[model samples]
Target: MSSSTQHLLVATAALGAVAWLVGVAVITIGIARARNAGDPDATVARARRMRTVTLALTVPGAILVAAAGGWYVLGRDLSIDPNWWIGTALATWLVTTFGSTFGRARQLSLAADRAGEHGTDDEDAQWRIRRVDLIARGELLLLVVAVVVVVLQPTAPL
Candidate 1:
């Protein structure tokens, strides 16, 4: 690929990753706040919206990651060992974060839906919402570690 094309691909990947991360963070915060309002209908609405948004973000994220020139870490200019560790940390963080949040959000959506239909607060849904927060926070901690790994450029001792 031409130098300009490579630069463009990298820039696009950076833009896409930033958008995805920020979008997820904002949406997760919104969902966390909505869950505490004690309104089943609103909570259900938020949960359903979250599911749609999550999938939307994920599809683009996957495409962007793929288009990142076949993993820039493996590029000839970079040292494979150090870059590989950072890349793995980042990849793991993204996958686990999304998996836990989506799983919890789905459960919350279902429970909240039932509660909305019945016109009563659902303990199950509320519990699930709390779990979502817990999971998000946990993943965020992992994200911090990933960030540090990237910044530190950790590599296995030879």
Candidate 2:
């Protein structure tokens, strides 16, 4: 790719990454706030939209990022330090990807709890949803760690 093309790809990837982060943070916070207010229906609604967010933002962002990485590495010789950071970020991404699976399960559980009569008043359901939120929190942490690894590009000291 030309220099300008590479720069454009990098810029686009950065934008997508930021957009994905913002969406995740907003959705996660919205779900947590609804759960805290004892509003099961609102919690379920927020959790349900997570699939849309993941499909629209997270998945595309990940693909664009990987494409940018592949393009950047096309004719370059990367040293251990660069590879180390990429490896670290990829490791976090792998964990985040797996964690998102459980996160989806939690969302389903929350929706199931509110299936018919609005399980807001059911302490058991509320507790279960809260536990589900814990998974969301962990997934969010993994994403943040991946971003940090990529941004900071930490490497071992000689």
Candidate 3:
């Protein structure tokens, strides 16, 4: 790859990494606040906002990462066997995106149902909060793995 292309890839990857880190931090803070909040409605609102911000960061970041990686791979000579790292990174990204989306939808639906019923019981609310936290943590882990794979450019024998 040309020096310019290499620099571009690095820059894009760095931005994506920063975004991922920020998203993780936001989710973590939201989780903490939700756990301590007295009102379920407030907790759900905060969580929804946080989830939206996290998704905003994640989708563009994933796109940039994928584009940079794809460019790097395609720019190389075709005679070479494809590296497994790219596939792994792509799969991780897909898993993170899909898993988070599904989890968020479920959490929101449950929260809405709880709100409509005006239930005071903390048991169900706590369970939903924990579920959201687990989902965010899982996504964060996958994002970290994907970043490492892309940045380190590790390879496996084809």
Candidate 4:
């Protein structure tokens, strides 16, 4: 790819990452609002949508990063061993996607099962708390991997 194209790809990847982070924030806020409102239906729907938004954010972000990496390797004419970086990014994507959905499904299912209930029981609350924790951990791991990839990539002049 041309230098200008590479620069554009980098900028796009950066924007995607930023957008993903923002989406995660929105999801967190939605979760909090759901819990505060004490509406299990809203909570369930929000949780499902949160996972969807996360995927919407991360998939494109990962693709952009991969494209940028490929461009870097090609543009620099380096003997780039992309396995570790690619593998790490893939792992981050897989874990974030699967983990978020799995965790949220549990919470949402429980909430739906107990909808029209009087109060939030300890078990349901605990499930939601755990789900949030799991999602947070997965996102943190993804962020760490993404930062490492960006910082550690070979940036020699083409």
Number of colliding residue pairs in model 1: 0
Q: Give the clashing pairs for model 2.
A: none
lDDT of 1 at 15: 62
Worst 10 residues of 4 by lDDT: 112-121
Candidate with the larger TM-score of 1 and 4: 1
Give the TM-score (vs. native) of candidate 3: 0.72
Full ranking by TM-score: 2, 3, 1, 4
Task: Give lDDT tens digits, candidate 2, residues 28-136.
Answer: 7867888777676776665667656666676666566666755555534455454687776656656665566325544545555564355555656565656656765
Ranking by lDDT: 3, 2, 1, 4
lDDT against the true structure, per candidate, is: 0.60, 0.64, 0.68, 0.59
Off by over 4 Å in 3: 36-42, 77-82, 101-126, 156-158
1 versus 3: better TM-score goes to = 3
Q: Model 3, range 10-39, lDDT digits (tens) per residue? A: 688678767766776687678767667767
Model 2: CA > 4 A from native = 79-82, 101-132, 155-158
Residue-level lDDT tens digits of model 4 in 1-158: 67788778668767766665566566667777776787655665666666666567655655565566556656756453544554555566567656663345455445544543533444664366446745765675576666677557544333
Assess candidate 3 and give its lDDT. Answer: 0.68
RMSD of each: 4.2, 3.7, 3.9, 5.0
User: Of the candidates shown, which would achieve the greatest lDDT relative to the real structure?
Assistant: 3
Worst 10 residues of 2 by lDDT: 101-110
What shift in Å separates residue 10 of candidate 4 from its native position after superposition?
0.8
| lDDT per residue as tens, model 1, 34-146 | 76786766766676776666567734654564567355544536664545865665575457545664465466566567667664356776566566666666655554465
